[model samples]
Target: MTIYGYRIPMMASLIVWCILWEIVGRLDLLLLFPPFSDVLVALGDVVNSRSFASAVSITLYSYAWGLGLAIVFGVALGFLMGTVPVADRLLNMWVNVFLSAPLSALVPVIMILFGMGAPTVIVTVFMFAVWIIALDTRAGVLHVPASLLEMARSFGASRWTTTWKIVLWAAMPEILAGIRLGVIRGVKGVVIGQLLVSIIGVGALFTTYSNNFLMEHFWALTLILFAFALTVGQLIALLEARIDYYAGARS
Candidate 1:
């Protein structure tokens, strides 16, 4: 960020927002907005509680399973769509439709199909995340330089060998970009799933806190979720940066 020819750190803006929140909270602008300090204290308390631990574990477990499957299938399908025109022609419209659709509405059908459990939550996360990853990966693969593919063919590289060694490497930057975006979406998916499916895990905590008007606890839990998403996003962004060479060279 910058202002008046001076650069501002990212955390500076966060601090500003925190101050505004604290002011509003102190003034009782909204009963739902608790004081930042009180929220911090509640956060500390929740962090040590067994319920919190269990909730975190359950949420993370579902997140991992969903994201893992998303990556595997997303990348594979993306590769196929990128390399095979027939496949892309067949599936492109459906993929675009899913990406543009309100996937949340499908949760009820998922619940009916999968039943009320972690499986529903996992599927929700996957549904929310997989499409964007596949799209980004496909775009990346399509952008791989034709010369590179010709070089691989000139070297007598088999289809599999060219795909893994040349095409995959060339698309690594955008693939990582897709994964990072998918992860952020997955966080939203997990929350939505838990809240709608059975109110298990962190959803339960949110329900209890909000129903009882425990604003501090509710905001504290929200902050934790936001932090988790931000941390994972930054990590993946760093990994993407490390593969910047591919993007630059391809261009």
Candidate 2:
């Protein structure tokens, strides 16, 4: 970032926000916010607790399963929609609707179908993530050069070989971009699912903290989730950068 003709590090903005938060918290301007330093201390304490370990394990388990399923099905659906006009015509409207819909309202329906506990949470994450991934993948596949497909076929490449080796590879950048977005959405899904379904995992801790008015601990937990989401996004963005040549190649 630039300020007064001087470039500032990206992290400077975060530090500034933290300072402001600290000042406001110290002044008791907001009942919900505790001093940032206290939150940091709470962070250390929370991390060292056994309950935190269990919560992390449960959250990660549900998240991994849901995201894995979303990736598998989302990519497959997208590939179908991209290649087959019939499938596109049939599914595209629903995909767009789900993408724009208020998804949280659908969680209760999922809970009814999947029942309580981790299953519901897993489904929630899948529901939250899959649509965007499918949409992006379809867009990527659609953008693949027709010339590439013709060349592959002329060279006697089998259908599977053409799709797996050429089409998917060409579409890697957008697929990864979709997956990155899906990861962020999946985090929200897992949190909300746990909170609404059965209050297991980090949701349980959140319940305890909020109900007890442990603002510092609550904020610390929130920061951990924010950090996780940002870290995953950066990692995927790095992967996208590495394969950006595919986008250039497409052009």
Give the alpha-carbon lDDT of every model. 0.94, 0.95
Off by over 4 Å in 2: none
TM-score for each predicted model, relative to the true structure = 0.98, 0.98
**Model 2 residue pairs with clashes:** none
Give me candidate 1's TM-score against the actual structure: 0.98
Q: Write down the lDDT that model 1 would get.
A: 0.94
Give per-residue CA lDDT, model 2, range 185-239, as digits (tens): 9999999999888699999999999999999999999999999999998999999
Query: Model 1: per-residue lDDT, tens digit, 1-251?
Result: 78999999989989999999989989998988988989999999878888999999999999999999999999999998999999999998999999899999999999999999999999999999999999999999999999999999999999999999999999999899999999999999999999988689998999988999998999999999999999999999999888899999987
